[model samples]
Target: MESKKKEKKALGLAELVAIALGGMVGGGIFTILGVSVSIIGFMTPVAILIGGVFALLAAYSYVKLGVYYKDEGATYSFYKRTYPKIPFLSSMIGWFVIFGYISTIALYAFTFSSYMISGSDLAESIWARKLIAIGVIAVFALINAWSVNGMGKTEDFLVYTKLLILAAIAFIFFQNGTMPVSEFFGKLQVDWEQSHVMSILIVSSLTFVAYEGFQLVINGVNEMSQPEKKIPGAIYIAVFLVILIYVVISFAAMLAIPSEEIIAKKEFSLAAGAGKIIGIWGTRLVIVGAVLATSSAISGTLFGSSRQMAVIAGDGFFPRILARRKNGIPRIGIITMAVTASTLILVGGLELILEFGSVTFLVVSLLMAIANFQIRKQTNSSTILTLLAILCLATGTVLIFYYEYTHQWEQLLFIVFIYVILTVFSWFFSIREKRRLHREEFPK
Candidate 1:
């Protein structure tokens, strides 16, 4: 194994706050709100609140683990430090997630471009999406590669502007929202009683992914200040804020536009919903905000993906070429992630990416919670928290699998393919490292 040593970048609570807020404020709110309102109607707000609660629970689990480990790889490094076998699993999971998020970033960029063109005949061209997406990726890649501070500053800017716009939008609807208490109760009835409840849970689980971005910060645990205190604080704050934002946006859309129209064109639904409420000018404002939000998301994840690869390299599980840090940046890893992301954009798909990541986040969350169980030997508080974390995770997992069974085989296969590749690479790294270590202890 080749070793390349480097210092970890220093980040504080402000940085963590930006990353937490930026991660969740992306395409989901701009896109998912309208569709969710159509499916769940007045109950959309209730569903967002429920999702927020679970996200907060997961955030706390990561906080405990991050504080205890004080390692660069977040859960990957935290679990590795706790048990030797953890690295193999962590590395595979980390790699899988890097690809998943990269794909999502591309998906958002594509969506942004599509919306930009929809309102203007002059902007309409196949090249517009391709050109805009590449530009979005390039701009963020530069921000992330410059330094942690550069990336953090960009994210902080994105977070503030995005929140202000969303808050303004929410307030507008506060004055204009239409679902009264009686009307809400009346519309809450969705055909069959028992079947709708079951269907609601399944669909709601899918919607929950949009709100899981708060947990995205867990990957950068070692990068934050007072991570023990701040990381969890940021997660709780971000989730509550996100859910409230979503609910308000849902209320606004439903008040200003018909839910049925939004449902019919769910893919391009948000722009229409926005235009109806705020006019053509308003739609453009939302699209600009959406682009910035996703650009910030890509910047944060680009940093995270590089860090994950760096951890894998440092562990002697991957080519140490990626382990080298130049001026506080992992250049090779960032480039690799960027190139992979661009190729994913070319592939032009997000369903596969979402399905692949959906199941694995549970695995990561469950493990992080379980870590609380191991460290409990050191402190009973850890045990109690881990128990609570596990309870939430178990329920989320059950809901996820239930959706898997009912949804489609294609979704199931997408997840299975990632697992298979991850297992194969895990073995490849394990065998190569075993040989390298033996040579180090007892020279040729």
Candidate 2:
């Protein structure tokens, strides 16, 4: 009877989907819209869709490893278990994955602040945005630290409400757009001619960061019901839904807003463009959607990543205090993540944070593909599909690097520098863990 009650209380498909969607749909569309539109023009949806395809490929390995191991540590856990001989490798993944999530957290919080204050005079003040971003992060951290069930329910509401609002936004824009369907196709043709294939591919790869939240599904395995079914089911469904949402929303924006205006407004493009096309109420609605999108994202990311952080800490890769839990919630890990993300928002520029996150997740996902490929038979993953995933993910990582090299070399250097710092931390912890093991074995 107790077991049945526990099973009943575990997260079901709906809550799992909400967690994944909450992670993916945050400030991603809002943050990428202006940047993608600037690069690919009317072909932004194509690039976004291509990004989703890549995201699906990345999820393949995650799903297999997730079901096979059923560990909430996720990427870090998978690699560690797959290659137990090399402690440093797992440590590297653990550090990179956690910081990758932190970068996304910072990205979402910053976007939240950007859209939150877009209408007010404070929008122009960087400090004001940073403070607000930090404030929102703190709020969600507390919510997550409160209880897992409360966080899940809140995420469900925020994610579904934002989706409905986004759908309505798309429909309204499509209905009000002056561009004919034929003209829309014509614009795409022109965009194809003017934009290089490499440029569109780069944008597509860059958009993968927006899809990084899918693995958060696997992170909830411990608290979830039926891992074998729900892990893959919820992840794939959420990814598909996100792709549809991003494509429809991007399509609407392309039809109703001018490319130049989108690029100029950047983070504020949706609300401002909607207001210009429709009215103040339209602007307010879009703002509400964006705020909801980011808020849920903050909550979901904190919920999943903090758990992973606690796992890594318990494994001796991070401060062990983070492993401490109050009523099964990793309060210290949640607080640490919130503080680090807040710091990143205070110091990092929006473009830098976005690009950094994209690159980090691409690297992490590629590593996951490699790990799954090695253990394909054990995980029951298709060898061919895993190989294809490796190839596609590798191509994405290279393309992003090439784009950064050609366009933003400074950002590339900064990303490299941050990795160096993380590598040092990982190596230190890996060595410490090794020594601890050695002491345990020898009893000197």
Candidate 3:
């Protein structure tokens, strides 16, 4: 009885919000800062704001579906339950979404390692970075495998601490910035000559992945109390906070660092900016904040996505072994995710991993919006908002592919190949499950 009570108290509104923030704050802002600045210059904050709007659109559907269904399976389960006739759709989402989470794990781990070695003598050693990335994933996997309560408490500390650190970094940048706020805004007008509307939209589309983890709040529905209320509450609050954080940080970086430097040191732009303005201590501060941010992201992703993976496996859409759980946690799923993400870190470069993740979640969120649109009445969702969500996400999806097609056709091809492979696997599993059900119903 006492154990049950303790378990119930493991995650509350604060912890739920922390998980969502942890997931969203990870490698997202850090990864996209230089890229956004490069593409839009002083208008990078505007692009981030637009990106946040799209995220809010995507969140609307997710929140509505989460409230209606309240399932821990989240994206996969919501779609499956909404459209029972097309089990393949659900299976495909499960596979694609899990891989999306894998891409993020790779993104966060890679970002963590990059910042970890930024000031060190081994900063340029690719092998050392990869090794550290793998090591961090392994460490977090063990932490997650140990206990849910422990993961939540650790996430709470990391997420909130990083928030404070990020705020401080922003404050320092604003205080000691090379560029004035008035000049920053003026550049938006004068710099318009250098950037086009299409470029800004493309940057905004890519920023979608930075907001990817808010849905993780839903994945913890079963662990939390009054999930219907908490899911939407935590997710909305987290997204709002993340948007503010990203926009402020982007604005600060632009003010403190030159666009050329930002583009050059794309991976560690914040740290580089801090070093220039506030010295080595400032750089070290940003790095520490980034490490904590990415660490919590890894921990939260492993916790939420592993459970979603286990739920999908239990539905027989994935290998049954993935469904195995210990101490109410999906041990096998957590380790498998860690290993796959590490392999991705080794094989894929930073930009490739970031783009793949952005595309995956954009596609997945678009699908969720479509699903929500179909059952708008049931979920008490506005038809106009749902339809608009679909349109916005669809446009974002097309913009990403367009950006990649023009810039990196090879990466786009790789993303397509991955989708084709996941589709095939989803089809095979769906058919097998269907056949088994058929046989059981009409017994030979």
lDDT of 3 by residue, 284-314 (tens): 9999999999999999999899999999999
- Residue 131 lDDT, candidate 2, scale 0-100: 95
Off by over 4 Å in 3: none
lDDT of all the models against the reference?
0.68, 0.90, 0.90
Q: Tens digit of lDDT per residue, candidate 2, span 176-291? A: 88778799999899999999998998999988888879999888888877799999999999999999999989988878888888899887788887898779989999999999
Mark the regions of model 2 whose C-alpha exceeds 4 Å error after superposition: 1-9
Superposing all C-alpha atoms, what RMSD in Å does each candidate have to the true structure? Answer: 3.9, 1.6, 1.4
RMSD of 1: 3.9
Q: Please identify model 1 stretches exceeding 4 Å from their true place.
A: 1-10, 34-39, 122-127, 178-181, 189-196, 215-224, 377-385
| TM-score of each candidate structure, all chains considered together | 0.89, 0.97, 0.97
TM-score of 1: 0.89
